[model samples]
Target: MVSQPMPLLNGEPHVGVFIKTASHQVVEVLGAAGLAFGVIDGEHAPIDRSVLDTMLLAGYACRLPLLVRVADGSGPAISSVLDMGAAGIVVPHVDCPEYARQVVAHAKFAGGRRGLSTSPRYAGYGSMSMHEAVCSGDETAVICQIEDPEGVQNAQLIAQVEGVDALFIGPLDLAHSLGADSVREPVVREACEHIARAACGAGKAAAIFLSDPSDKAYYQELGVTLFIIGSDQSMMRQGTRALSSA
Candidate 1:
């Protein structure tokens, strides 16, 4: 079995779109549009297992890496998405190094207690050997979200955690945690810069959610390489409004 390449590991800036709708067409359209990946918004959206399975299938058909932002960081929650073949798992509100470590434990099998099963879709329905399955599981990207002030304070240690591939900054939550009026507040920006620096120091990928595409340059300068910008629904709404105005 040939190993699949992880796009985020390619040393190029990867742009990903968030998917909140249950439509498979969104996945195909985004993939065709040259987006590097899709982040299924299970954290805020009402995405159940049935919908998630369909979206995962759509991602497979489009050859698009789909990372699921689990509603909460739990062993069962992380294991379920990995078993269903999510390219990676994005755990929310990882406040400390221990929490980041726990996220890795739940997503990866090496020194992890993630329940194993060869019959899952990711295992090729038992076509793969146990070793192959374990290897693949180990490769699954584990991203931890640093949303709170505590998370920002512990960002360096969190980035240093083994098996934690990336650090994702939650702009809005970070702003709220800093008592800022908006994500663009200078305080929030400083915190983001600090987190980005920590991630870079640890040689880990740094990611953020930016609604405005123009903000990409600013974050990129701070050593962030992964940008999750806008959702399918937002894109459709903006496109429709632009067409109507035109």
Candidate 2:
């Protein structure tokens, strides 16, 4: 069977949150909360393959499209997550067209380097034939994170790469790469706009992490259609603080 399409592929202003906790309950809760999607923070979090497997199961059980942010973004790393039935992958430090191409190559099965396997959950436990698996696997989203100045400079070309679903801006990393004090710095803001423009120009989704929901309008005007508002940890902390104050 062909896999379900990503919400981002619709080119709408979809909001999601990062899932840093390894608990399946967190995945279930986020799905219940009406978030458009969720990203498992495998990059920074201590979530290993076993933990990810359980999380993906919870996601599928709850009908939540959960993407995984890989730590290294290598071929094996990309393939492993997709094989586990992750909705997609968020590969970081995709600073150039070649690297962007590699990320797509690793995630796609047709005309790509991704190894074949019908035993994985993505293949419905051998229910899908090779052809069907290829088609369904290729539908997995391949989001490239543009975190460096070099990535911003190459955003136009990177966004044009086929099989790339979205250009995700890692705001903190981008700001750090530019030696800026904050994402609000003039230079950082300009770079973010440039990346969004490039992605929009190429008919791809432009995504970014936002600390404040109020800033959504500003980025939306710049052609950003996908917003990762905050992590589960941050939201929990905010809720706890608000409860204390009240």
Cα displacement (Å) at residue 187, model 2: 0.6
| lDDT values for all models | 0.87, 0.91
lDDT of 2 by residue, 1-246 (tens): 335346667977899999999999999999999888999999999998998999998888888898999996688999999998888999989999999898898999888999999989899889999988988898899999999999999999999999888999888898999999998899898899999999999999999999989989999999898899999999999999999999
Worst 10 residues of 2 by lDDT: 1-10
Alpha carbon deviation, residue 105, candidate 2 (Å): 0.9
Report the alpha-carbon TM-score of model 2 versus the true structure: 0.97
Candidate 2 Cα RMSD (Å) = 1.1
Q: Candidate 1, residues 74-155: lDDT per residue as tens digits?
A: 9888988888888898899999998888888888776998888888888888888989899887788899999999999999
For model 2, what is the error of residue 66's alpha carbon versus the real structure, in angstroms, after optimal superposition?
0.6
